[model samples]
Target: MKPSSFLSLARFGLKTILFRKTDPILGTIIVTDRCNLKCRHCSVNNITSVLYPYAQIRDEMHKLYDMGVRILFFCGGETFLWRDGDRNLRDLVTEAKDMGFLIVNVVTNGTFPIDLPEADLILLSLDGARERHDLVRGPTFDVIMENVQNATADNICFYMAINRLNKDAVREVCILARETKNVRAVSFNFHTPYPDTRELALSKEEKKACCAVIADMMKEGAPVFNLKSAFPYLIENSFPTPCRQCVVMENGRLSVCGRCIDVPGLCAECGYFFVAEYTLLFRGKPKVVFEMLRTYLKYV
Candidate 1:
């Protein structure tokens, strides 16, 4: 991140904390719900399968920016699958920066080539090592790895959603992120089990064990993009839900926190680490705020 961008974000954070503002600082736009692969734990893919038109997407970006969203994420059923005539995902990233978004990130399943060097981070899903990952996301691990190895920039962050099947492979992914050339770091979220995927949800003890491994990896100098200070809140789901500093826009409709916010009773079981980290940060949790500074500066 650029110094100016970092400073601007710092100002926003300080103001939000001091004033106890609920305005959003981060926003996500779902470019499309069209996906090539159907992962086992996903409930949102292929419902509409619509690649939203470029004009509509551009308008959504403007709306988010106007609403004080400086950190932008272009998400997908598969981002690389989104293309409207001549425009592609890369064009959106560049356009977002031109439109003055301080930090623009893209989230993809890593099933396609990664060439968006303009993005600050490409949150690529890698669930686990070969067999485990293949089991969850189908037999595309080799293809995704090849894409990561040949990506145009060193901005890839391994995004792992830990669940029953892939929980044991967390260490394998952390090691991969540490060793992979184009990868910058690994970020984690425990599987937020939707109605259909309830069986994949981890028990409290399982979540505790996963956090222990992640904390140990951080100590060993692995570049993890998540804050260890928020692990307890994440494990217990004790942190505030529907983070006020974050919002999501899908197909022009907006929602606070995430699209999952619409799922009734799901907030209590939220496993998203960022929600725990951010909500705790704005609520003036000293350790979370301090460790967020340390972790983000080091890896983001």
Candidate 2:
């Protein structure tokens, strides 16, 4: 992260914390919902399979920028699959940076070639060890690792969503992130237990066990890109819901916190670590603020 970008974000954090502001500092633009892999735990893929156009996405970028979203994420069905005419996902990322987004990230399942070197972080999903990940996301673990090995830049971060099938493999992923060539760190979220994937949701005891393992990994010098300060709140689900500092824009519509905001009763059980981190930080939690600075500076 550049010093200027860091300073600007710090200013936003200060103002938000001081005033209890509801404005968003982070925004996610869902470029398309047409994903190639249908994971067992995902319900957001391929509903319409529409890859939104470049012009419309550009307009949405401007809208998010105008709304004070400095941290931008390009998400998708499969972000790499998006192309309008001759332009690809790389174009959208470069465009976002050129449009003055301080930090731009692209999320992918790592099923395709990765060439987005300009992105601040390429969040690639690597759910678990080969057997467990293949079970959840199909037989693509080796392919993802191969792509990671051959990636053009060292900006990849493994993104893992832990559930019943993959809960035991946390240390496996932490070790991989530490040793992997192009990977920077690993980020985690517990399964959110959407209506269809309720069976995969972890019990509170299970969540506590996961957090304990993550903390142990952090102590052992594994590059886990999350705050240990928020672990307690996350395990208990006591953090605020619908983080006001984050927003999501899909197609032309806007949603707060996440795309699943509309699902009834989902906020109370939110498993997204970011939502807990940002909400607690903006609500003036001193530990969350301090640890956020340390964690982000170290990994992002």
Candidate 3:
């Protein structure tokens, strides 16, 4: 809505129109699969189980950058767990920035506290209020809370995954985000049931209910990080869907389709929010365009 954001929208529009073949728009790199906490909703099966070497990580970034990627998100089975020499996640951010990435992002579980990379954003995977959070993610709520508060000086985002256990805590979490200093915004996602975690998946009805609540909160000025077009996908359980080409892993394995999708046929009930967001954007929704621009401007 502001002039600077408007200019950002213009820039995004022009670049998207002109740079069709330059590079992938977003690249998610997982540094490791070893996690400290065995979350009930996560399947630890068939992970690479090793930290990717620092050299390989550098080379991979170069490859993605040469292809024209401007955004890279550092993902992990616990990215903070990954280590190479004295290098850590923060180092990855510094290096990625040097490589000319427009912005770098990190997603972490918040178990092991460490200084983060100078990334444009850091998304802490928070599920709910303390009790519910502890139930779903183990007794690490205090730790995550402490770390999140400590990391406020940096631009950081909180990602809350709504499930049956944490559904009641939505309002509280929203208030927490709003009241807390150094908290940029909060994004809500429904639980995506990977093989060993199907029970954590919310029912279709529950998903609708949560989406309605979130929509109401947005109208009241509660800061939520969801595109306007993508909002409906969360609400109605029906909308345009995107085909994810592939997600490359640290071990050089490309988990294209079957790998990312939970095995034994639970993909239908899966709730990865980005699928819908990307779908609506690629479908050319005007609101999605504006939301993307707003996010980019927040960083630029």
Candidate 4:
């Protein structure tokens, strides 16, 4: 992170700690639910297949900015597929930076060309190694890797969702992140069991084993984005749910945390490591603060 960006995050962290604020400092706006791929673990795609108009997205950005959100993420059902008239995802990213967002990120499956160098972070989904990732996310691993290599920017982060299919390959992903050009780091999240995807959720034992692998990777100096200090919390699922430190906006409706909050039991089963990390940090966990400083300094 740049000095100014780090300072902004520090300011927000201090204010949140001192004032006991529950308001969100980071916000995600789903530009569109229209996706090109139908992964087995995903439940949010292909419902509407409508690209939200540019004007509506702009309005949503302003609304989030008004709500004191400085960090912005543009999510999808594949952000590359999002378009309104002649505007593309890059236009929205530029607009967010102009509107004073400290960090602008885009989360994608990495199936398309990653030419958006304007984005501070391009979170490319890479579930596991070639065969396993292809099994879950379809036969696009080679293409995604090619796109990653072809990408002009160096801000890509490998976002892996560990579940039944890819749990065994977590170490392989760490190696891929280390060897791949333009990939800055790798972040892991357990598969949250939404309504129909319960079978994909890892058991507590499985989650612990995966965390052990990640911990070893961290010790070996792999560019993994997860905090090693919070592994215990993640294994026990003891962290608070429905983290109030972040919010998500889809269409015009805004929900605390991400869209998972609206799902019935998903919040109770949330496996997003960042949610747990942020929740613990807000509650003033000394170890978590140190972990965040170390991981984020390396990431940015």
Candidate 5:
């Protein structure tokens, strides 16, 4: 990260903490809900198969910028599948950078070619090692890995969403993150039960065990991107919900946190690690703040 960008984020964090602001600093725009693969644990994919037009997406980006958002994330059902005539996901990312977003990130399943070098971070979903991952997301693990190996940029981060199906493969993902050529680090999020996917949620004991494994992997020099200090909060779901520091815009609707916040009881069952980290940091947790700084410097 550039010094100016890092300073900007630090300033935002400080202001948010001191003033106890509920406004958002980071904003996620769902480019489209259309996806190619149907993962068993996903509830938001292909609901309507609608792709927002370029003009509409551009307008949304500006709207977010006007609302004090500096960091931008372009998410999707499958970001790569989004297309407005000849334009693709890369165009949106470039436009976000030009729109003064300090860091523009994209979250994809890594099924398509990894060619967006303009993105600050390309979060590739790699649920687990081959067999286990294929169980939930189908038999595309090897293809995604091959795409990662052939990626044009070195900004890829292995994003694993741990659930009952792939909980044991967290260590394998850490090892892959450590060994993969263009990959940066591996980050984990426990499965958030979104109605239909309730069966995939891990038990409290299972979550604790997974966190222990992740912590041990980090101690052993694995490139685990998640803050080990935030593990307990994630397992217990004790952190505050709807972290007002982040927002999501989808299909012209602005929402605090993400779409999950609109779900009936999902907020209390939230398992997203970043949400916990941000909530704890803004609430003036010194350890979480220090760990966030260290992790950002190391990975970003």
Candidate 6:
């Protein structure tokens, strides 16, 4: 297997195994509902709540950290769009770091320029190349590229959700990510058919084809983040994941989402690929471990 940080973690996994028995190691915190763009597949436009202040978010982080959460991800409609009177996303990252969190993650839509707040990982939600991407996002690929080009740091990467619209261009996106000036690596995910947004989800056949391409790219040592063994779980939908690591905090409150909490019968339809990836890690899949380590090394 390729040498990676996760290999080192695997060496210490025996020691850390005791911790997983007691508490969640990672969690997602939606610091704000504020967003600048209204992507058709997102629920950001439906949100009518105001952005919460930094103090409240900081308090939430403290509580989670006290609960043994080692990794914190700042997700949002667009986390970079979040702001208080003077503080910004970078401030949030700095605070999370000060609280002794192992890593801080951000998921953004690549609209605004991210100037401050270095994160352990910044997953930029990209659709596809200009023409296809313009259909999902606005005709602002130039601006997005500008932001990405200017965001020439070691703590950021790209995540392109494979959908019917962009499925055919998956390879192109992957190549672009590796060849792009500022992009570090590309992670792939399938679109979730949320309440009002089902059109973006890929078909079973399409997903399989995309996975085949991804697996090939991975075999070729392309810098793409994918769980080697767990990728099949995405194709067949037979993967088992213990989502004990995450407790989503949305709009200043705990929300497990109806899909994960109320009607778990529909959890099989969930689009978060990280779930299967984590399961593969717990299973000690070497390639999966390598992928996870590669991710940490790139971001951390």
lDDT of each: 0.93, 0.94, 0.70, 0.92, 0.92, 0.71
Ranking by lDDT: 2, 1, 5, 4, 6, 3
Query: What lDDT tens digits, residue by residue, belong to model 4 across residues 153-196?
Result: 99999999999999999999999999999999999999999988
Clashing pairs in 1: none
Pairs that clash in candidate 2: 35-77
List candidate 4 stretches off by more than 4 Å: none
Cα displacement (angstroms), candidate 2, residue 63, comes to 0.1
Please rank every candidate by TM-score, starting with the best: 2, 1, 5, 4, 6, 3
Better of 1 and 6 by lDDT: 1
Candidate 4 pairs with clashing backbones = none
What is candidate 5's TM-score against the reference? 0.99
lDDT-superior candidate, 3 or 4: 4
| Candidate scoring better on TM-score of 2 and 4 | 2
Please, what are the lDDT tens digits per residue for candidate 3 over residues 1-300?
Answer: 346535543565456545532224566777888787776667752265788898888888887676555567888788888788898888989999878777688988887764763777788887777888888789999988788777635566778888778887777777777776667778877876775667777777787778777777778877777765676666565654323422444565544322464365455554666666655555567788678666556533
Model 5 lDDT at residue 240: 92
Provide C-alpha RMSD values for all models, in order: 0.7, 0.6, 3.5, 0.8, 0.8, 3.4
Question: TM-scores of the models, in the given order?
Answer: 0.99, 0.99, 0.86, 0.98, 0.99, 0.87
Clashing pairs in 6: 90-117
Model 5, runs deviating above 4 Å = none
Global fold similarity of model 4 (TM-score): 0.98
User: How badly does each model clash, as a count of residue pairs?
Assistant: 0, 1, 0, 0, 0, 1
Candidate 1 versus truth, CA RMSD in Å, comes to 0.7
The regions of model 3 sitting more than 4 angstroms off are: 1-23, 240-247, 255-267, 295-300
Residue 88 deviation, candidate 4, in Å?
0.4
